[model samples]
Structure formats: structure tokens, C-alpha cells
Target: MRTVPKSYYKHFSNSEQIDFQKQSSLITLPQPRAHPFVPKDHPFFVRTDLTAHEMGPPKTVRTISQEAFDEVVKENMEDLGMEPTEALQDAIQTLSLQGVDLSGIVKCVPGESSLKDNPLIQSLERLKQLDLNSKDKFSDEDLNEMMGLFDKLIELCGGNEGSVNAAVATKNGGVELVCSICYKMRCGSKRVLDSCLKTMALLVHDVQSTETFRTGGGPKLLVNILIDGNEDPEILNSGFAVVAASATGNEVVKESYMELKIDELILEILSRQRNDSIQSLYDAIRVLLTPDDDQVVASQVYGYARRFAKIGIARALVHSLHAGLSSPSLISASIALKAVAVNDEICKSVAENGGIDALLRCIDDSGLQGNKTVARICCSLLSKLAGSDSNKSAIIENGGMDKLIVVSARFSDDASVLQEVMSIITVLSLRSPENAARAMEAGSGDLAIQAMLKFPNAQQLQRSSCFMIRNLVARNPENSFCSVMVSRNLSDRQRRTTKSARMQPLMH
Candidate 1:
């Protein structure tokens, strides 16, 4: 019972019209809406009278979240028949249009058939082929791919602390990778070179890989980058970070770094007007001073510290500590000073370089905020410097004792810090009778006695406490510490304390 328009069948013959009607009947059409108006772009389309300005201000665009962006990218990539790396690149561009900063997306990962054919290693090889000046240099996709490869390699080794075989890194052309990065650095591509430096930072994390990196002239290249890119904070920061990662607890790498005179370069950087480079530089210096349990390594670390002293590490540390009392640099510099102080000659050198004044300042400033770590390291460095009689005089002249005694009392409940405080008092007491008298005036004898009674089982504390008392009594009996000990009825055995001295009843 359908009625056709009069013009529809006018152009067709009878047989053709019947065939067309049959075909039209098989085709499905959308049901027409029951509306007073027509749909736009329909065969019978209509226009509205309203103008575009009748609407309010334009809609605010929302940012695309990373997950949603990744999904969209994945779909588009599949539709376009693109690979993972290419898809990532396209995704970066898409995200950029949405005003997202994709600089950090370059951290990358993956699997394999062969080493070269392995997706992660293959990504690294492909990244190397990229021109330094190419638009791809800043591509988030490339950064992600390279970093992703590093993550997978770390996984393959098990974790950051996991050992990657040098043979494996070599076979996979990691040596060449370092060389290529070095070449890019020399090419003066600051933007591209930053990405390269970050890669080197991630690669030299493992023990064997670090050795391979060192053998591949990685340290030299890093130093060169640091030296050449001296004004570039990003490059310098990354370079120092690489040094820290590569040298941490790696003795062979430490020796290699020492030979490069990296200590001198670090000192030079520290001596400059550099606020941004402080953290990285301190971190590098800390790792460089890592105390090794291996005798051979320990000696090498000691020797390197002497060189550090020669290059004015103490002065640099003092400057950094002065800049920020609560900063990590303060703690690191203090620790480095303590390590270097193990050598008596270095102790005198530090004192000559105003180390005592620096330590006193850090102690006083850090104590205001009750920063026990900084205070503890400061006290420890002071105690180590006080190993030399001349340094002890320097400490006293710099108002070191007042700060030490106050900090000792403030942190008395902390056994380790108290032990260091007492050790300094012990060394100071040995310097002269005036120091012994000053100790008594500061209640050094009472603090030592209280420490011995509180930490009866802490042999180091007990020994340091006993030594302080013995020095006080032996050096200045008229100073009242002698009568105080006599009244307490402390035994001769208790009075005579060395590091190896055994504990006995004090009231006998």
C-alpha cells in the first residue's frame, strides 16, 4: 500500500522500474524521526535561522590522560599498520597538541629472537642512527623507547643491584653504544646529548656493565662532557649522576675515576657560582668516598681522598655547607670529611683549610632544627679532625667545643652521636690542661659517666667515655673531675679504658 512520488518512476521503463523497486525493497533505510523540522544533510535537508554567535563562548578543551592517550594511539597505530616505536612517536605528537609535556616519556622496555633482533637492543641501535639535529631528537617516542630498553635490560639483570654480564653487554654492542653517545656529546647537540647522557646514567648501573663502560672510555667521555658542557647544568648534572652510579661500591671503577682527575673537575665546579649542580656534585663526591671493606679498595679510596684534599675538597664542602645547612649536601660533605679524616695527615690538612670552622657552623645551624644526621656527621668530622693536637687547638679556637658539648647534650639519647661527642672531648682533653679544664666546665665528666651508665653494653661508648674521664683526671686533677670520679668511687679498671678495655663494676 506504498504510494510513490510521481517523478520517481517517470525516467524508467516498466521492467526496469519493477527491478529497481525490488532492489529498493531489499535495502534497509533509517526510520524517519517524527519531527516538525527536517534533519541536516538529509535528502530533504533544511537550515536553521540561528547564527553561530548565538552560542556562548567556546568549550574549554580538557587534557588527555596518559592512559587514554596510549589507548587511542594503540588503536590508531593498528589501523595505520604501524610498529611500536612509530606508534609511540605518533602518540607523542598527538599528546603534544593537547599541551602535554612528554619529555619524561622516553623511559623504555621489551623481548627477543636474537640479540640484535631483540626489540629493546634494536631500539637502541635505531636510536643511534637518528641525526642529532633531526626533529626526532626531541621526540618523546625515541626517549621512551631508549629508556624502555634500559628498563628491560635492568629487568633482565633482575634489578638495579643485579649484575649484567660484560660479555652480554659487549655482544649486544653496549660498548659501541657508549662510543656513539660520546660522539653525540662532542657534536654539541645539547638537547640530543642530554638524552644520551641519561642513557649512559641508566646503563652503567650494574657491576660488570660499569666495568665495561669504564673500559669503553665512558668515564673519560663523561668528564669531557662535564668539562665541555660546563655551563650546561643539565649535562653536568647527568654527567655527575653517571659518575655516582658507575662508581658506587665499584673499586675498579673508582680507581679509573681517580686517574681521570675527576676530583679536580668536581672541585672546580663546586668552586663556581653553581646552585643547581650542588646535589649531583655532592652525590658524586659521596660515592667517590665510599668506604670499601676490601683492603685493596680501601687503600685506593684513602689515596683518592688525599688527592681530594689536595684539590681543595674541604673548602668546596665548606662553601656548600654554608649555602644550605639542612641540605643533603651538608650531610654528604660532612661524611666525606669524616672519611678523609682517617688519615692523620688529611686531618691536619682539613684543619688548615678551615674545616673546623665549617663543622662548627653546620653543627650550630643543623642543631636549631634538630637535624641529628647532619649534626652527627658534623660531630664525627670534628672528632676525626681532633685526632691531631694542632687540629684540636684549631677546633677549640673555632668555638668547636661549645657546639660539640651542646650538641652532645641535645642528642645524648642517641648512643652513636654521644660516642662521637665523647671521642672528641677525649682527644681535646689530651691536647692540654686548658682543654681538660674546659671539659670539666662543660660537665664533660658527668656526660661521659651518664653515657657509660646508660650504654653499658656499647663498648665504643664506654671506652670513649672512660678515656674522656681518664684524660680529664690525668691531665687536670685540680679541675675537679678527679675529685668527682673519686667521690663516685670509680675503679682503676673502670678508669683505665681503651678501645679493647673490658667493662667491670664501677662502684667497687
Candidate 2:
């Protein structure tokens, strides 16, 4: 009874194994569970159904509200006993350090006297508060206040802080406000209009403000001002200043002004003997005609330069170079002439208008007065004009070679002036062996030798002298002989100097 059979035990074991398999099939394994506290969109949450590369929720950007900024500034003002402006600046700096986005926040403090803390803001606020549409005429007080505000704006937008202040003024609608004020006062007050134009000149120095000026019809306003204020020297000066400032490096503004026939206006204005605005007018012309690195804009500017020549701007510039013109005006006119002499036709136009003779006279006078700057610019313009065969002939016929030789001798110590003189000689002797012979005879070879010997470290001057020598000797055998002799002498002197340097070390 105690001994059970092994087969009976084996059958029980098989039955138990089959029962265990059925139970395991009927039962389900528990599914993986996520933490209860973790949200579905949390970065830590992993879903098996989704790919691993799914992006997480977007980050929140830190920002400060106007009220929050103002409260902080107020706290700084009360607790730290800081001035309102100081406290405001400190608050901006602190929040900025914390990576707070301060865009759209009013930069000024709140209060009836809020703007009084900042003159720039105060000026802008006062200008915006003016009701130009409501009144056809402004009293002396209103005009005076407006003038003061404009002057303040001008002061703020000039000098080392010009870029920053101009940006701030543009952001505060200073450009549009001034343009509107100018429109209302264009036909009203000369004094106010002049101040407004001057202010606009500085305001448009900012890039965004220039765009605002152009889109807001500032160019048209400026042209009208020039036409109506043609008789007023102050208005013309300020208006031309605005043109110069706005047209600089801005092709669209230049095209806009050109479309309005500003060239004609400038020519007409230039015809007058208004000495005060001559510099500004020339500056405006220079800026308008000057080309940048952009090929499309440069081509358009070349067209404008041609148009200026057609409209007698070259003659006008030549006229400005008359004997009695101020040195400043003379220099400005020469610079403007260089900008206008863009091509052969315009260069010939400049030459045909006595540009050569005028420039020669300027060189003589600058030499007599020891004015190297004037001479340098005159030589530069002469070189530009000399690019054309016809103009080069005109220059040589006008005693240009003798004038340059005399200038070089006079300012031999001035490497800058000599470089310019050498440049002109280089251009004059470009392809003409006859001109090269003439330059050699006129002491140009000696000038180059002297320049190279004197300014050994003057890289540009040395290079220019080399070019001059090459041009002078490239076509003429006689000139080449003289240049070789000069080079031999220069080499001998350099050898002697080196010998002295080595001997000095030995002596020591």
C-alpha cells in the first residue's frame, strides 16, 4: 500500500504540466505604466507607439511687462535713491542681464514730468504734441519751441553718439514728426523751416529713418523746399545738407531725388552766387552721383552723372572754382567735379567747361598759400579728367604739366601731394610717348625720384612713383635712360646706407 508505481506519478506530472500551460495562456502580463505625476506632453514621457525623435514642448521665453519694468524702476528710485533716468537705465540693464525681452516696453518713466528727465524724449514728445493741422499759423512762441526741439534733436543726433541717437529718434517717430512739421512750416516760417531741414539732415543719417523719409515723401518735400526756398540761402544750405545726408549710400533715395529732377534744381540753384550754400550743394551733388560697389546701383549712378553733365553741372562746378570762392567751397567743388567726371563724355564736358584752367588756377593759388589739401584735391581731379584723351590734351594745353611740376617742387616734402602729382603724370603719359617726353622735360622724372627717395616707407607714394616712372619710360627710350640712371643712383645710395649700418654695428 505504501509503494506507489513510477508510471502513475509520471502521468500526474504530465497532467499538471498541461494544466499549467492553459492557465498561463488565459492570464495576461501587466502593461508598462508611466509615472502618474508626469504629464503626457512632458519631455521625460516615453510612448512606445511613437518614434524616438519626436520634439518636446516649446520653451517659454522670458519677458518683462511695462508695469513690471516700471515697478522695478520705481523700486530702484525709492530704495536706492537713484534719479528717475538713472533708475530707468538701471532697470533696463538689470532685466536685460536676466535675458528679459524688453521690446515694446516704454523706455521712459511714468509721470506728468516723465519726459523732463530725458531731453531727447522730451523733445520728441513736445514735437509730437504739436497740432500742425489745427492751425494755419503758429505764433512766435510755437515756432520758437519747435525750433528749440529741432535743435535739441540735432544735437542729440550728431557726433560720437550720432548713430545711437539717430536710431532712437527714428524709433520715436522723430523723422515722420519732423517731416510733417516741415510740410506745415515749409510755406510758413523761414527760420523754422531751416531748423527743421537741419534736423532732418541729422535724423536721416539713420538707415531706417532714411527709408521712412523716402516712403513718407521726404524727397518730394525736399525738392519743393529747394524750389520754393531757392532765394533763401539758409534754407538752401539746410535742404542741401539733408539731400547729402539722405542720398549717401542710398541708391533708392538717390533715384527718387533724381526722378524729381533734383539735378535741375541743383543746377539752377548752383547758377546763383550764393556763397553760403555752395559747399552743401556740392556735397549733395557728390553724394548723389557717387557710386558704390553694387554694379546695378553704380550703373544707375553713372546715368545720373551723365545727366548732371547734360544739365550743365560740370560748368556749375567749374564756376564754383572761380578765384574768389572760399577755400572750403573750392575743395568741395573739386571733389564734386571728380564724382561727376565718370566717363569720357563727362570728362570732356568738364574739360570743355574750363575745368582744366580752373583746376590749374586752384593749384597755383594753393601752392602760393601753401595749401597742400587744395593742391592734392586739384591734382586728384586733374588726374580724373586726364583719363580722357581729349581732356588730357586740354589739360596739357592748359599748362597742366608745368603746373604739376611746380606743385611737386613746392610740396616736395609732402608725400601726399607728390603722390597725386605723380598719379596725374602717370595718366598723362599713359600711351603718349610725346606726353612722356614732355613730362620728363617738365621735371616729372626728378619729381618721382625725389618722392621715392624721400618717402621710402610711404608705400602708396612709392608705388605711385613707380607707376609714374614706368609710364614715363615705357614708350620713350630717352626717358628710360634717365629712369635707369636714377635707379642706379638710388641703388648706390641704398648700398652706402647698408654699409654704414653694418659699420656702425662693428664700431659698437
Highest lDDT scorer: 2
lDDT of 1 at 168: 43
- Candidate 2 lDDT, 140-235, residue by residue in tens: 778888888888878887868776677667766778888888888877889989889988888887455678999999999999988998888888
Candidate 2 global lDDT:
0.73
TM-score, each model? 0.61, 0.74
Q: Per-residue lDDT of 1-508 in model 1, one digit per residue for the tens?
A: 1222233333345765565445433322233444443232122111223233432233223333334445644543455444555555555553443234443122121111223554445555665555343432335565455555555544543344333332344445655675564665464557656766665666665555677787777777777878898887888887787889888757878887888888888888877844644466777887887764253523467677777877788666766655557455677667766755557777877766667777788788767778788777777777777878888788877777777778877887888889878777877877477987887887776787777767778877877676666677664548553545534654555544432212221210
Clashing pairs in 2: none
Off by over 4 Å in 2: 1-116, 132-137, 274-276, 293-298, 324-328, 489-508
Question: Model 2: how far is 243 from its true place, Å?
Answer: 0.8
